[model samples]
Target: MSNNVLKNLKPYEVFKYFEEITQIPRGSGNEKGISDYLVAFAKEHNLEVIQDEALNVIIKKPGTAGYEGAPTIVLQGHMDMVNEKNQGTEHDFDKDPLKLRVEGDMLYATGTTLGADNGIAMAYAMALLASKDIAHPPVEALMTTDEEAGMSGAMALNPEHINGRILINIDSEEEGKLLVSCAGGVRVSVTLPIKWEDIKEDKTPIVIRLRGLKGGHSGMEIHKGRGNSNKIMGRILYDLQDRVSYNLCSLNGGAKNNAIPREADAVLLVNKEDVEGLKAVASSWNEVLKNELKASDPDVNVQVEVLPDRYNKMFSKETTKKAVQLLYLIPSGIQTMSMEIAGLVQSSTNLGVVTTSKDMITYDSATRSSVKTLKEDLVNQFKLLAEVVGVECETRADYPDWQYDADSKIRRVFERVYKEMTGNDPEIVAIHAGVECGLFKEKFGEMDMISFGPNLYDVHTPDEHISISSTERMWNYLIAVLKEIK
Candidate 1:
């Protein structure tokens, strides 16, 4: 094959396919175009492909030469990427392709995510689909959907649709590691009523905006000492209330529960006289937080800007006090570290999203862990907190955790294969975040599974990038294992 056929093909030819797929918009819940593209590519290669009702596409490649009798293996990954961006970026994920750039050995986007989490897996599958010379057993490519959000497609998967007993999930972020277990997750939302009172006293609209925090994965980065904007904003408001009389008008921060809140904004109607004092307080708090979170979030910015107009109907005194109290009392960040796995977080919660409307102010929180009892216990803790704060709590989309299976045959096979290939033992660990493996295991009981992937750093953030050399090594390792399996 000519090198020109693979335009940006570096050490790993699969990255070229990944680059092509990056040009197409494959955000969660909007994967029709990408799914169609995959189907077309499969048909062009004369491969047998099936598109299920859920838009899941499966392409099957027959065994190569004398390896026909070898057991089949299913290669799985999601087709969608999380649409997240930085504070002041003007990139549209739907219409524009990912602006990929290479710095040193890392491949990243200009102002958006590089989409290598599953894009690499999709590329690897495509490479397997297109390759004819590589010797391997029967191959089945299962491209799932909506994995970043809630594992909607995986949960919806019918076990009767797939035939492979062994599945290799290529979604782990780190390299040289095998993941056999992952945490479950649940999103809890608290809605509180607003009591707006007409302000007899004149007040100015002062915006307290929290930005420049290095927000990261709520699960993996929770113990890394980064500050949550939602929590910090609550602390600021709680302290400001003691010093000055302010009305909470509007507050907004964060979008997804799995990501730490980077930027938050609150428009508060404060007494005109206290503007200078509030600004001074904000500056002092910024300095304090900068010193505290510099190890994790170096650019912690907290600014208070004065606005010209006041809120149409400011909050009554009673409502303002209660709202600030609730914000201070909400539980966020890592609650407890795991006892089973040393240095692993067992339970954590994030106050990710906060929004204000004319009628009410609502805050969204998500709690996650590998232990089911601990996860539920955290939810109940939040419920009690909300009750004392006088807010209605609601839970949604609870997913099962993939408990660690010590006797899994797939893990043993991967460990042996990795040790033989690299001459060093790979790290085996259980993650605190949720993966589709849990849902798949629930559906297909007794299915042998393990997840591994190339080195992907800063996932779900604008800083997200993947290593080209690591990807090449990963491909070689996977091919070696696939050929070794009988």
Candidate 2:
């Protein structure tokens, strides 16, 4: 229970469990280790536990003596964390544990994500399930998988597995806000055919590297005007087509579909005479990008890497043109703002990834919208663009938006408890990002749901961290809410 990184932290039990879970790598599409660990913890406490085929773990505990007949309460959160780090940081998310560090009131991972998004949820659930003094109704801890890239884990849930009508989802980022509605999203990918050609004797290869932009959660921070390196790479190529003759080898950027692209690298083969000119152009463009992003992404830059030896391969001129065209023509960033709510974004898209393979190039985008028709419209818009450029488009891991519930009993309990404890009313909010509450509503219409969490900043990015004092307040609030539910 005592660790140097978070030693003697308030709310000892929650931090203890959080530190333990951080030692195990739980990145998206890789939840077996964390899931099994949850099962072990449940068994150690002599509690009933079930793990589904998709690696979603559910642990059940009976109610206290006084609340044996109270309706069951379901606590849920995702198991996966967005795996991101500083470009040069040496850490493998699949195997290495997050290196925890404390800075004042914040908890951080050295040069990487801290996984506080939902890891704190698991920590809180573990603390509650193992405690002998807390008063509450029967508890069902639902830990799902792959909520970072997609909501596949939540979508794969079986109705029979969840018996609780009142659900508390501990996945919100803000401490005092209760989320009532959320935007639905889909992952759309476009694949284009490529033709590789041998390096020509007269060509010179130089890599254009884009870096230093502050990429963030596409849903949470899309309105901040942060640069998308994939889009910038496309813009550079499209603009330089008239000044220099070149063929592209590859255009790759981004690590996750739900995060804005922070850096991109593109290789180009140009006429030997145009190499110097290209470098000059890159320098000017770098300055331009910095100036434009002074407020949003001040460190934005572009570097030209000239190798001592000639490159071995390059894409054919036809394939190069098609690839550049796709990058240039496709749209990204916030698409539309909500007219109903002030300062709310209605629809947006993040062109998060671009990768080159042996025979094809793929562009992955995460599109979100609170309105079903608008979500369909944006996905269809991407497909139309793909059709024009002779590329294939496909959608996967789609999830429904959670609508606001005005008559939610769980929400009323939260609102009352939070006010009684804080002497102020908690803010009722509708988020643009997706949450599992929407999927649960689809599966169980009568279920009452609400989401709240500690203060987490810069999620889905390397700068992610959680507040220490906020965690204590959240823990106290959760216990108070649970006791009131009975």
Candidate 3:
């Protein structure tokens, strides 16, 4: 099944390895199977290997004949991929392999994410390791797990296990750009206790839904000014407060802290007499939002539907007010841009997930900044907001930023190789998105690193895909760089 799709692809060895990888279920936090596969590959090739408790794999290969005395080079990429699928996709990420297909110059999965972000890097590394002809220094292929959820695998890796002074990170998304630096970040989770009472006899139950937003990676597309469904839903509820009396029953939306919320829905009990008024308010906002977000979210939708039976219970008036206020006030997009690097986002927060249960309503937010102080300040802001709303707040998955190195030799080598291969100099820039390189820098201060990869679009979402021709070019560029390394 995989052969027919990849038969015409160049760098045949790399694509073969990639197809094999796609068959294994390697979603973040579920990487034991892929980790074992790497171990087996290393053994099959008679290479030295280490499998850590965190499931990070390190495979070592001696240098080629003439380059035996050269410095060891580390090729790094994460083993796990973000698990995302379309609304009605039936494939299970835990056991089913990605359904692969080719479209023009790009490769994608049917109704799901393609996982080419870092999987291609793993394929490149494996192909290089299995080669007997490509010239290179001592190679260390480091594969870490759970990079999408957090940098857990990289955080747990011991610096002593690696001796390489030069590292090439293959986890970037662009085709002709080199990622020199990235933001540090942390996840903040807030829980607010809800006080619920039986629904009043004179009230009616209705559901308000905000959908059709074109959501993307929070850090990558936050500056695009797309509508956040959770935030929009909050605005509708807050605005309706003055015209209609409603008690919150349930509010839920979004799935991950890294992806923007594409849809959100809320259930409420409203005075029977004000049902039509609430629907009118929702319709009015729908038009306003469509106009406001037409450029970035042309398909923005706001819908209100009445329920046949009333909800058994709803939040008390005070709790409802607090919930609405918190949603309205929490920061949801780019907060500031970089002063040092023009057009770069310096600090931001994403209101990623919102959910409500009988006992509590919880919000999950992700905050990021290239500056440590600014990152802390953004986190503090969330903490203060949660405190004001009388909710419990905690932060987790804190990772450091990968600072730019002006004197990096590896960056220069990659730039030179890229120019020679494509007749154009690669753009060197920092990204707002978080990468495992940050954690690697924190662990190994002496390591000089740069990140580059083939073109991948819409990562962390169902529209994800990789450019086939770009992958071939990147493969040749990497081989050239390896041969030039001293």
Candidate 4:
């Protein structure tokens, strides 16, 4: 903890609270200690605290002496974070504290995610809890869990637990922006069965890996034109198999459902006589890919290594042909860009995870769209694609889109405050990525919501960093809005 509370309390002080939080591991669906810490903080501060069965915490601060009759406002944000690290990061997200570092005006963690997405919101909450000088209306600070993996905690919020109808979700990544809408999303899994056969063609088994792609959040960075490892590996196989007779053994890629796959590996048995032809085919495809996505994915790489293996069996010829054809044809990148918002993505799909087994293989992907009807149409399109490929398709955990509220009162207040603080109007926009605001609005009817935050870059990845200067600007805006809100 810092020595001073309010003296010279800039935005980085809020970030200091975030640095301390990084010491505690609070991954999705596992937020016991963090929850306890929050309750204890509320108790120590003499705030009214309520803990729900869903493990959601709401700490209420009664309105300032003069603003008692104003509407109660909810300051909402999630508590849990996505635990991710780089290829060689030694820090354990479960036990070790996040190593925070400062470079210029950016705050980042060493070799791991900094968890500033919601940690910033948590710090803002702590600042509010510690503040006795600021005059504000009745405020409810809601810290939820399991937001990174899913909106389970937000979905479980009891609408009647608090009397706050206006909510400000401090979870967005961009500063000087008001996020009034967000896309709805769901996960789809396609499973295909495979039959094994003996490798009778005197073939050599080789382990091939396609790695070093700059992976990012599937929803946020889909239009950045980065290469998907799953698609890259499939393309390599598709081209190589045409030049050399090969039997595929196994294919696996990616770890999470929301991340664009960064690496993929495949084992294949190829005849020794056709090795030269296979090499040439791979070279041609690599050149083609490098030329095609040079601007977006400059570091994309594909490598192969021969392995000594007595292959009992490989995928049956018929099954292998079907699998390869299906995987190669499935769309794994941005589908459409929004005509309404310049540089905004409307409909997109991500081929996130793939795994192969003896009997069957499973590939998981996600789709997102802010337009409800368009989302349904895209899901139907995916179902049709799966049917054509002879695979069983299923979708789960569907969440509704947070429709844009152009006339939202909360947005008006935020816009006025932002203008007053910076002498310029903030950008009021909608995000293509899904936010918990949609889930909360779905569970609780007619809740006015707006989301804003400091600038954060490359979240859910090892290169994540928070802009300290932007955090200061956002903090000033937040304070100004609190002072003006009725």
Winner by TM-score: 4
Q: What TM-score should be assigned to candidate 2?
A: 0.75
Give the alpha carbon lDDT tens digit for every residue of 282-400 in model 1: 76788888898988888998988999775678777777777777677778888777665567777788888888887888888888877789889988987898888777999998887
Give the TM-score ranking, best first.
Answer: 4, 3, 1, 2
Error of 4 at 138 (Å): 3.1
Greater-lDDT candidate between 1 and 3 = 3
Ten contiguous residues with the weakest lDDT in model 4:
1-10
Query: What are the models' TM-scores?
Result: 0.78, 0.75, 0.82, 0.83
Candidate 4, which segments miss by more than 4 Å at Cα?
Answer: 1-30, 40-47, 81-116, 126-133, 204-212, 239-245, 270-275, 301-307, 455-473
Residue-level lDDT of model 4, residues 1-486, one tens digit each, is 432322243564575677667777888877887788888889998998998887889999988878788888889888898788988779777777777777887878888888897888988887776688777889999999889877788888888886888998999899888888888888888888888887666888887788678888898888788888888888788877657888889989888768999998888888888666666676566677778778987777677777877788899877777777767876677777766666778777888999997688888888888777877887787789889877888899899888777678989999887787779998878777889898877777889999999999989888899888888888878887887876
Give a tens-digit lDDT track for model 2, residues 119-138.
Answer: 99999999999999999999
Error of 4 at 264 (Å): 3.4
Superposed model 2: Cα runs more than 4 Å off: 1-55, 59-71, 78-138, 145-155, 196-209, 242-246, 265-287, 302-317, 339-342, 430-434, 455-472, 483-486
Whichever of 1 and 2 has more lDDT, that candidate is 2
Enumerate clash totals for all models, in the order shown: 1, 0, 0, 0
RMSD to the hidden true structure, all candidates: 4.8, 5.2, 4.1, 4.0
Two-way TM-score contest, 1 vs 4, winner: 4
